[model samples]
Target: MKQLIILTLASLFFTASAAADEALTAEVLKEKSLAMCESKASVLPEGEKAEALAVCQCVAENTNYELILEAKKSGDDSVAKQHMEETLKTCKAEDASIGS
Candidate 1:
């Protein structure tokens, strides 16, 4: 039936869309990690800075932190803004010095 055909097509479309989302999410996370590392690497003091940089690197590598990654990659300004707020909160909570 036409209805059955339409449903199958719809399912395929949604599945493909989800896969694309996952791929984009992964790409965004990778970019965010690299950026975080680079940013920390730039400002951290020589010896003490190494510890901060390591923390950032650990956060970049260890956490899911996927939502911000998605928002940033999608170029959604509102989402990006919200994500930034959340990220700042996380930094403050996890490492107070991060807020500085």
Candidate 2:
């Protein structure tokens, strides 16, 4: 009975730890995406920097972190590049509509 109790407690502790790790992983992925966006936005001309940053921010906000992680693990950047292109296209359309 004592051994059963100890095992139960150990299982609970491990389950909680795993959950915390998963949450941490998600947060880290989000930070990485934002950093990537910031890096991409930094190359824009001074006049376009703000709009570019906004586009990058949108990309970071809309990106699928899980797909990004999978692509990273597989050493495939296509998914990430696709996301960037889509974000830029959308932002450009918005800018055009605004007469910018």
Candidate 3:
């Protein structure tokens, strides 16, 4: 039937659109993460500046992009905040060990 064919095509179009949106969201998250790291790193003290930058980079590189996207989609920040806190804690611990 023509209606069935039209429905199938529409479904495919929606699926493709969703995939593209997900990819765009991922790219946006990556850019945001890097920008956040750069801004945070710029304000660190000279003595621990490198370590601080390293921590930020570590956090950015290790964060779960999918979790961030899910949180954003649901309008809930808890997942994203939890990820950030965990990343910071882990990175800080690593940085402390480096200075030891």
Looking at candidate 2, what is the lDDT of residue 69?
49
lDDT of 3 at 87: 63
Candidate 2 worst ten-residue window by lDDT: 1-10
lDDT of 3 by residue, 6-68 (tens): 232233223323534656566566566566556655665666556666766666667666676
Better of 1 and 3 by TM-score: 3
Question: Which 10-residue window of candidate 3 scores lowest in summed lDDT?
Answer: 1-10
Please provide the root mean square deviation of candidate 3 (C-alpha atoms, Å). Answer: 16.3
Instruction: Show model 1 residue runs off by greater than 4 Å.
Output: 1-28, 31-43, 58-66, 69-75, 97-100
Error of 1 at 63 (Å): 6.4
Which residue pairs in candidate 1 have backbone atoms (N, alpha carbon, C) closer than 3 angstroms, thus clashing?
A: none
TM-score of each: 0.40, 0.47, 0.62
lDDT of 2 by residue, 1-100 (tens): 2222223223322332343446535456556556655665566567766665565555456555565445545656676456545654665576557655
Clashes of each: 0, 0, 0
Pick the TM-score winner. 3
Q: If the candidates were sorted by their TM-score against the true structure, best first, what order would they fall in?
A: 3, 2, 1
RMSD of each: 16.2, 17.5, 16.3
